[model samples]
Target chain A: MSELLIATHGLTKVYRGGVTAVDHVDLEVRAGDVYGFLGANGSGKTTTVRMLLGLVLATEGGIELFGEAMPKAGASVLPRVGALVEGPGAYPHLSGRANLTLLDSTDGRRRRGDRRRRVGEVLEQVGLDPADRRPVRTYSLGMRQRLGLASALLRRPPLLVLDEPTNGLDPQGIREMRELLLSLNRAGTTIFLSSHLLAEIEQMSSRVGVLDRGRLVLQEDLATLQAPTGLVRVRTPDLSTALRLLDGQVVDRGEGHLVVRSPDAAALNAHLVARDVRVTELGPERRSLEEIVLAASESA
Target chain B: MIRVELVKLLTRPRTWITILALNALPTLVAVLLAVTDLGPRPGTGPPFLSAVLTDGTLFPLAALGIVLPLFLPVAVAVVGGDAIAGEVQSDTLRYLLVRPVSRLRLLVAKLVSVVVFVVLAVLAVAVVAYVEGRLLLGDAPATGVVSVSGSTLTQAEMTQRTGLAFVYVVLAMLGVAAIALFFSTLTDSAVGAALGTIGVLVASTVLLGLDAADAIKPYLMTRHWLAFVDLFRDPIRWGDVVDGVLTQLGYLVVFAGAAWANFATKDVNR
Candidate 1:
């Protein structure tokens, strides 16, 4: 019930050979929030998650889960956090049901007889057949992903941390995973996941944190980030003069229209009008989430 | 968590396959010896083959000898090396370690599982060899082998020696298992871990051949592997057997410790 389910102070990780995977990242995920971590491949997103989970040692800084200091408290705190990081991490020779049962038995809090029911429930929830006895090695990429999700849900923990839960899923599989995650979040599990799929994050996340290179560049609610990007597509009779007057400002020039982005489109139009530039067509345009993210990453 | 480790170990067809394959050599030896009747004079063929030809009870002993030098130990190496390395290769260590269990605790579970595997493998060799020997070569009258004290022992004494001898073999292989587990913790490649474990043993065996290694030979993990032979000797020569036990214990301690320290500090990037 802590305010922040996860918090980090100056968290950093430097691998051998002097490669810094994560650099002084300070992050917070409040309780009951679906926090999406977005980054390009090899953008230190996985490394940050690993550090938070105590799977990787941090070169500097500290982390806390449920108000307890990490690594030190990870053992005590981990049973309350379910996770699927990067790989299926499943025993290929065991059936899907067998895999979940085996993993569930590891939890100290797992009750007698509750294990089978929990495993069965998770299997059904993940859309896998409860009675399927096929080994995991024979499963398709999507099935393996579902199995991974099933393992994370085995405990029904308060927090579910997944890394690229939709990495290799097909369109339908992706949608299923998205809906499953949304439902889990709705049921009060604070979900923290990382993915390179910006649009997926935009659709599924209530809040998002962006990682570029090795640093956390931006963290904001999707509502705030999805705000009308204040982009205005304007065409003027004197295009050259409009360009001059708009110097030192952010602008994108298209074939016919000059794209100007600002918080207020009316003010931009008034300034252009005062400059004696006869505007032909002016309309406010909103930027998509992908475009906004692309802009941020490009500038980084 | 240990239960999880056991279930995982048991459900794999590879586990039973490894055990069956390990028993293959002894089974082959039994069938060949029974048919050919070509008695490989004492100390010539295998350590206990001559006895196996005469006494069905000794067939299990002969099987142990065949496997101890190569077969069973290799299986142990495979299983032990695959302990964490297999998980790492499959990227399952990330999931396993994220549970409530600590790295050391997981390592212990894995080590215990490997030990259970070794015990099962050794016992398989013994049981199958016993049945094969009993059916093909035939058992002896409750009489036992002659003791160094120059006295023939009873069935009880022989059975006791057999049990002690098997236990000693398990301990000896614990050295190899620990070594393999250490390498398993060191690498993410399961094949490399298994091969690396076997590679070190092979190198040590090769070293035991050099005249310069005489002083260190006694300390080699491979040196005391056949000490189980001493248990079969008259008067039960405890000297070499005890030394082997101590040497194996020493290796297990050092190597198990090394595996622990390395695994504890390792970053589970895979």
Candidate 2:
């Protein structure tokens, strides 16, 4: 297995009013892995990322980046990491290129040509025109997002953390982002991303963690999380009586449909028919990530 | 590190425009006084030049008061204001913090940049004032400091006094710069940093002005801010300048430390 590039052990955070913003969350992200952090609004995803970055102090817990303790890791760990948090905050009054040029190696020693060349490369990678000199304020939301990504890529760090990277992108922009992330991972960069968009997570992530009410409700490989939950949707003439007669646990009993968790579909059908309920159809329900996540959160 | 900050500073048009306007304001005042022939006759030494220089120092010092009240603080605010708050507001603090750089380095880089600008503004004022003083008062030097206690100095002493007076004024401005910088750490909005700095300065000035109110006078930063004017005295009472520099240093250290501590502890998530 690849090394765990980023890890958080029993992380907890409490804001003013003793609100548990994050509570005892354990997260492990492996190198070269695209880890998807999925959570609803107010689920502590951002809080977790902030802790990992050392932007905010953790109330209790430790975080490790590349096997070294953080944020005590200091400048030693950050040099190898790049991130785009919350929104794409660029210097609105500055040109796109100017924004990217604001941070560099601290010793005032820079190969000017190399810096310029790298900036051009990242801009092109993000699909921004290399020569575009317009102030960032003039750029559209998608363009600004691209500029932000360009800034993150400037130093070519090994690990990249992005929060809601697709928050303000069109369909084409989203596709480009997905492809770009895949390419980055292939190039040996580990990516940890958080998003409320489940479909996007499903499409990009190798592993996923779901946070709910400041707790990690679920963490699993993408394949397992996306696997068919084996929920059977049943439509019967007498839904209420049919649900009562069914051997499986009833998940949903509505006007014309019923959903149940059961492997023995044939046994369920036979039992339902014997109860004078005419079964119209019965098949496995294809659960979307949205449904599974909501169920997990509710259960937690 | 300086280059990165310089690039950031130079790229923003507002930086140049602000410096330009500030430099020009005094020149404009000087030109108006010269054109209106608003001074003592040439052989008699221009009353207008002395009045102009004293108040030029005072007005710009007042403008310095305003600028410190707003401009330097705004500048300091922009630096400290954006220090972490800007990152938080822009959501880029995460990216910057995650990099190999420490919070202290980042804060130091920003503070250094603001100091550079403050230095720039002070130098610009000194140069413009020199040119205006020369043009309005002629190449000859003014008399010694007109002592509040009624004493006079020779011409040679007067020249030294004027030069030293300008230096003290710049030093006094540094006190204002430090205050603005300290306030900048408290807010993200440049406006908040600027306005808060000015508000504090105006209050300090008020406290300093209250003659009989002995309680708060000694502690106020404004109390000794004008002591640079004492450089004009014939004997050059080093006491006031020494006291002023020491007070300014004390405030710089105290305010700067307070800002750093608050910033180091502030949740960047804000």
Error of 1 at A55 (Å): 0.7
Q: For residues B1-270, could you state the per-residue lDDT of candidate 1 as single tens digits?
A: 788788888888999999999989888888888899876887687777876667877789888888888878788888998999898887788888888678988989998999999888889989999999889985666556755355777778888988998899888888888989999999987788889989988988999999988998888888988878777667788898999999988988999999999999889888
Candidate with maximal lDDT? 1
| lDDT for each residue of candidate 1 in A31-57, tens digit (9 for 90 to 100) | 888998999999998899898889999
Q: Indicate which candidate wins on DockQ.
A: 1
Tell me which residue pairs clash in candidate 2: A75-B100, A78-B99, A78-B100, A79-B99, A79-B100, B39-B48, B40-B46, B40-B47, B67-B71, B69-B198
User: Best candidate per TM-score, number?
Assistant: 1
Candidate 2 per-residue lDDT over residues A91-208, each given as its tens digit: 7887787677665444244566687788778888998975458988888988988988887787788999999999789999999999999999999999999999899998999998
Stretches of model 1 off by over 4 angstroms after superposition: A229-284, B138-140, B148-150
Instruction: Point out where model 2 deviates above 4 Å.
Output: A105-113, A228-286, B40-92, B134-163
Question: Fnat per model, in the order given?
Answer: 0.84, 0.66
Give one clash count per candidate, in the order shown. Answer: 2, 10
Enumerate residue pairs that collide in model 1: B148-B234, B148-B235
